[model samples]
Target: MGYLALFAVGVTKFLLGKNKNEQIAMDWRKNAVQVFRQEFDHVGCNSDAQSLALMQRSYSEYEYFASGRQNVFYAEANLSLRKRHCLFTTLLFDLTSQTEDLVQFNIPLNLPKNMPLEFLVCRRKDLKGRVSKLTNPGNFIKNPNSKHFKLSEAEASSKNSLMVLAEHDEISNNLIDQEVGLVLAKYGSLINLIHVTDLKQYNNFPLFLRAELQLTSESEEAQYTLLGLMLRLADNVAAYRMSQTVVQKCEKSRKQQKQEEQMQVKQAQ
Candidate 1:
């Protein structure tokens, strides 16, 4: 349903084009469509990215707000962090439906209300099927209350989504980081896109993606913890894009193969 709305915006934009300019500009169209038609689609980004960039720029300029949406989120410090870049994701909406005079759409990201340190991770290789130096599945427990409890290898392997005991440093590969009452990080919810959300504003991508990070101290730099998260989001995006490419290739191959088979049958007849 959402994708259909975005597609409609793209079609509308193609009919009514925007003037290419130096200032920040956003439109309802797929800004890359022209380049796509010319086979140089990698040229620019869409309106969604532009809006996000503007929001980021606003934070860079004013840099302060007592409360409301502009409040200083600790993760915003990551914007100046080393070896990292700002990453934002948003929901795409059509502007056409909202106004008759306006020809653009609005894109807003579902920013986290608090700094959550949890994100989801799929099992790369089942421990039961393979042998390695990694910790045994049975030796770890996910809940802080059950720190000493051990999960059986049989029980762990059978489950698809294992609740990662994230807040505790003892058990790593945590999918959710919960300390006290606040959630720090979390993986994707039940949806199509993979999500990495936090409780505080993620001005840049989170850092904890490389390693399982459970904050031991309240003073720890939240910006750095999110770095690993940002990297992991990149991995997820890359994997999703690769799957799309593979699917396109398979579709083309199937079409060609079908045509060839039809030709052969006609010739035999």
Candidate 2:
């Protein structure tokens, strides 16, 4: 009789322990997503209680949020010291009402409130898998050797020369440093450095081809056009800076040439 009573107590203790562990796991997951949403401001429709509730619920445990043309799936998992937030979105065709392939989007963090969120769609599964690693897209340009570029120290340090760094290639940093060092030796402060990551290799279609198709008068054209316009603006800014530098160089060269000619006439006299 005593043995039976002890067995009952042991079983009760075992069940309680299991329940406690489960609760701890659940609490940890909830806290994680909450922190992520707060940090990234990933919440949708701040004014709508229903939308907020739906987002919380969906993000609570790998669920989908759909409204009209947009569909988003939220997934959260604990990794090391942080809880990773992964959200995937797909746009459904308004005419055919078919869901498109999953399009990768960006979750903006550590930026001004008015700054627009930036997103990129890549076909690379590995890149998609590493979305969590991209906590800051703005800093990607600052770090020449970021996963988005294959730049050498030399190329990265060039003051004003535009450098193209292929993200997917394995280029030696030492070589880049050497080349940039050589440029610095000649043009001390006249070098401009630029790093561009072409994600076309990760896309289903060639980037130019996809861009051409996107320009077609389709419903998604507006989004594509906006993206193109942003890229164009960045290019324009870079070109303007380059043009100013070239003009300065030309003016300096003309002054030097005139001085040399005067010196030659003086020697003749």
Q: Each candidate: RMSD to true structure?
A: 20.2, 22.3
Using Cα atoms with residue i matched to residue i, what is each candidate's TM-score against the true structure? Answer: 0.19, 0.20
lDDT of 2 at 114: 18
- Candidate 1 segments whose C-alpha is farther than 4 A from its true place: 1-10, 13-160, 163-269
> For residues 144-194, could you state the per-residue lDDT of candidate 2 as single tens digits?
342332335665454432332221112213223433333333332221221
Give the alpha carbon lDDT tens digit for every residue of 64-173 in model 1: 11111111111121111111111111122222232111111111122323232333333323223321222222222233443322345664454432334332232232
Best model per TM-score: 2
Model 2 TM-score relative to the real fold:
0.20
lDDT of 1 at 113: 30
The CA-based lDDT of model 2 is what? 0.29
The model with the greatest lDDT is 2
What's the C-alpha lDDT at position 149 in model 2? 29
